[model samples]
Target: MQSYDVRRLSEIAYDADNGVTAELSVVVPLYNYADVVIEALNSVVEQDLTAVSAIVVDDASTDRGGEQAARFLAQHSERFATARVVRHHRNQGLSMARNSGIAWSSEPYLFMLDADNRLRSPALSRLLAALQCSGAAFGYSQLRWFGEEDGIGVADVWDPARLSTGNYIDAMALIRRDALLAAGGYATLADDHGWEDYDLWCRFAELGFDGVFLPELLCEYRVHGASMLRSRTNDHFDALMAEMRLRHPALLCSSVVGVNP
Candidate 1:
């Protein structure tokens, strides 16, 4: 993708030299969601948090999803301080693409958003405020399932035990990038893609950074046949669970996984 500087200094946070400085960085890992990626970008642009940057990592898509994303950002360049696209030389998986974006990010807080999903209005501000007030490692927003509209899916308080049995927390969360880096970023799982987010949460628990669940609806999860989570059946779930247990035996089996005190 081509590079361009077309943003005003007043719109973005900056230091003495007017270099790009932001409190949050929204990293979007794009695959082949050309149909809906713009809507996702729109959601990010409409966020209540003004001091934010966006990075789109296109994972060598067969379609022109990356180009479309670049075009959208170019048109709405002023919405964010910095908006750029990263094109992978080859087709890498979601985890690698996300890690690439993470490496490019310099903000203290980060939000990992898939191309298929989007944040609700005012989500970033609310999540950030709650994260600061609660002194938690990350802020998790309650999100509803799109396409299904099966009411709202609310997350409970920081429950590490529940993570062992199931991953109630979706990957759509605002987290301290430093803490995430300290615990290691999202794991690359070949057997089960669904376990990646769960494994990351377990790692956070292992590192003693508890997640704070915000019960308000802050995002919408799009459901479709091409979704990564929907593709995983019950066949590998058991194996994935066993793998998580083996990888983080101390984290899962210990009495301190969810215990805050």
Candidate 2:
């Protein structure tokens, strides 16, 4: 990572009127991951693409994550001239934090990033090209799960058509802001099955919003102890999948009440 001198918090907070239009808006909803938030922010900041805005929504983190992010913003004012930090008065779920970021962004394209994940420099350019050329509502690149490695080791590819049957695109995918808003954003359903991104993808299909998948790994998804999916037990995962199938009958080819081959 390139080192830059940190600026003052007040200086970073100053709002400037940049006449240039934003090509994309990156929204990261942060919880208590103070240790990793700066890395996530830097990934977006160092992107080669111009006219991109990074919006970090602090979901009322009780830990020092929020304070650390504010401090980083203070020193990196120029890097995030268009960037803004919004906070909730109380704790809201991840979906709510994402929705808040969407509401605040004015860019045409929106890229959702998990606070612990990092994106490669060309990832944004590649996804944007696919979205533009295919005329799809969104696009996703192959993901490389990161842990003890510095670069990509394995890749996950998805068929766009299969995604209609089951969610194949992760939350880090790039999506059109207008299409997302038209689908009514993320749904807050039963607490036991709060699969916000999956629900949103299903709605996108229903609304005839198209998407394409790029086969190259462009983002690094960190897997650690604090990972959300890791924290969920087997029963929790099963319950959530069951609820999802029940809620969206069209997505499942097999009987909702029975197991599939």
Best by the TM-score measure: 1
Could you tell me the lDDT of residue 190 within candidate 1?
59
Query: Candidate 1: TM-score?
Result: 0.87
| Clash pairs, model 2 backbone | 6-75, 7-75
* Residue 180 error, candidate 1, Å: 1.2
Where is model 1 more than 4 Å wrong at Cα?
1-20, 253-261
Q: Candidate 2 regions off by >4 Å?
A: 1-19, 148-166, 192-194, 253-261
TM-score of each: 0.87, 0.83
lDDT score of model 2?
0.70
Give Cα distance to truth, residue 124, candidate 1, Å.
0.5
**Residue-level error in angstroms, candidate 2, position 233:** 2.9
